[model samples]
Target: MAEQTPDSLTSSITSRSTTRRAVVGVGLGAVALATAACSTSAGQQEEKQSQSEVTPLVDTRVAFYGKRQAGIDTPAQAHAVFIALDLCEGTNTQALIRLMRVLTADAAKLCAGEPSLVDQEPELAAVAANLTVTFGFGEKIFDIAAPAAKPQWLKPLPAFDEIDRLEDAWNDGDLLLQLCANDRMTLAHAQRTLLKGARPFVTVRWVQDGFLRAHGSEKPGETPRNLFGQVDGTVNPRQEDGTIDRYVWGENVEGLTPWVPGGTSLVIRRIHMNLDTWDLSDRPAREDAVGRKLSNGAPLTGEHEHDKADLEAVNELGFEVIAPYAHIRRAAPEKDIERILRRPYNYDLPVAAASGISQHGDTAGGISQSGLIFCSYQVDPLAQFVPIQRRLATLDMLNTWTVPIGSAVFALPPGCAPGQYIGQQLFEG
Candidate 1:
């Protein structure tokens, strides 16, 4: 079993290009030190420090190391790329461990706004841009590593009947990494660097890129709208006061393997929105499909978006104000543990849409492609996400315009403390 605590994680700096280490060590070491000092004292001076003193090019940065992964609960950044990798032939437990140690070490440095100890272009690493890199293990990761430590829900989706088309290219993998940031260059650099580290042990299986409203583009608390123009994530679980603790984090779940304490499960579905055909539907039809208003995202049965949808309330015609087949009605949790925290991203494939690629294929170049990378985090996929998905798959009217082409579920561990690598508990157990 990997020990509960490791002594060497802090030392896992990517060997930054040794030739440049002399110069970079002095430069980046100061930046990392200042960043750490700021973390220790949460005061006004720290909060209101001169803009000139901080790295001018990148102002916002989410701490890379914490109790929980940053990207899951952190407000969605402007850009993201989700990549999955298949384990190379002959990889075993030891190889997996070595690869993870290197990847984890590099991820930590990049997350903290420092170049990998071996970073070639140290300048590019300076733009923190709220960069966050989160890792998840696929079901196959367990088969090769500690099979006994595998979580029950860490597998591919079951036979989903509503799916119009599914492709192997986007299906399953041995690993998953989500790279997010506010700046495109920073995001691109991080992706390239991480993939290079992973090249020896795994091959790229799929890459799905997504984005939300740019930071400051919308009001601070506003929910982002999807390509369908509906305010998505209208009913996400609250992160404060332990609501997220209850639904999204997995420390207290009963009967869980030791590997998953303080960890969670993730679902990533690439739902292709048929904009060409959706444009044919009228405003009322769209509203009926989602059970929310297009203008302000209010529930059909209520005036404001956050107003509870009166599922039982009747219209003058004696019909329920919220239609029985509406997305909201079907998606709302009917019992405890049915709710999941949704953190989805809107995806509009520039080249595919502009060039007329077929949308059914499981790739970015698929024709007429524009949709959502529908992501949700939950303590248990079976208890929280599956039932809701089944309801939507069977009868929701919105299914007419959306097709799930790619789907995956990953087991995400909690953040590592300074000295430990992620998933240390799993290996130790």
Candidate 2:
């Protein structure tokens, strides 16, 4: 990729060739630091200062070494790429350990706005944009590494025959890499670098790219809207309220995991939204389907997004304000323990005909195939996630417009300190 030259600096430099060399040099730490007492021109000092200062957008960093893995509790970035890979045949515990070390080291550097040790495009590494790379392990990984340490709930979700049209292309894998960033370039670079590092031990199984509102486009704390135009994640647990701590982090929950305190389970469902049929439905029908106001995502009987949903409230004709089969009603947790942290992203890709690459059965005679990459994190999938999914699968009206085409469950290990690699406990514990 070509380096972007600043217009201000471009005019000051003489020839294009010289300007490129100068810009490259400036980017490569050629800035001259002059004290106030030093004899340096004011313009040169200003230029030096401008080159040194990085915008917060690009400079933001999420620590790669932590108690818990990032990209889970961290605020959602504008873009994400979920990569699932299967371990190469004959990859044993020691080989897996080596693979984790390599990938973890790469993640540490990339998340800190540095390049991989073997980075060919080091220039792209500077724009971290709050990049985070999180690792997950599938059941196959444990079978190879430490079968005894595998959690009982670390397997594929129970078959939801009625609502799921499962496709192998997006299904199971031995490992998972979830990379997110506010900048697509940073996210892409991190993905490439990590995948390159892991090529020796694993082969790519599937890649799902997703996005939401770009950075700075929406106000902080505002919930993101899905492709369906409904405000998503309104019912998510908040870190300040201890919901995230109790549910997502599994503070007091028993049967939490073979990996806990700093570990969680991730459920990825690639739900394809039938925009063609959804567009045909009327406003009231749409609102009734989701049991939330289209304008603000409030419950049918409430005025604000966060207002308690009046499930029993009635209409003028004596009908329940929130329908029994409405999505919000069905998706609501029956018990406090049933809650999970949802962090979904929207994906709209060109149709097979347009892109000349067919994926699953996405040739809907439209210009694009759009859907939500439904991601949820919890301590235990069977206890916390499955119950809610069962309710939705049986009788959520939104099911008419959405079909889950892909599903995978992964065990996310705790973050590691310096000199340690992710999932180290799983192999060593």
- Using TM-score as the measure, the top candidate is 2
TM-scores for all candidates: the values are: 0.82, 0.85
Query: 293-330, model 2: which lDDT tens digit per residue?
Result: 99999988989999999988999999999999999899
Q: Which stretches of candidate 2 lie over 4 Å from their true place?
A: 1-55, 254-258, 352-363
* Clash totals, every prediction: 14, 0
Worst lDDT window (10 residues) for model 2? 1-10
Quote the positional error of residue 264 for candidate 1 in Å. 0.4
**Least accurate 10 contiguous residues by lDDT in model 1:** 1-10
Reference-based lDDT, residue 251, model 1? 44
lDDT of 1 by residue, 239-288 (tens): 54566777888544453222455678889988888876677789999998
lDDT of each: 0.75, 0.82
Choose the strongest candidate by lDDT: 2
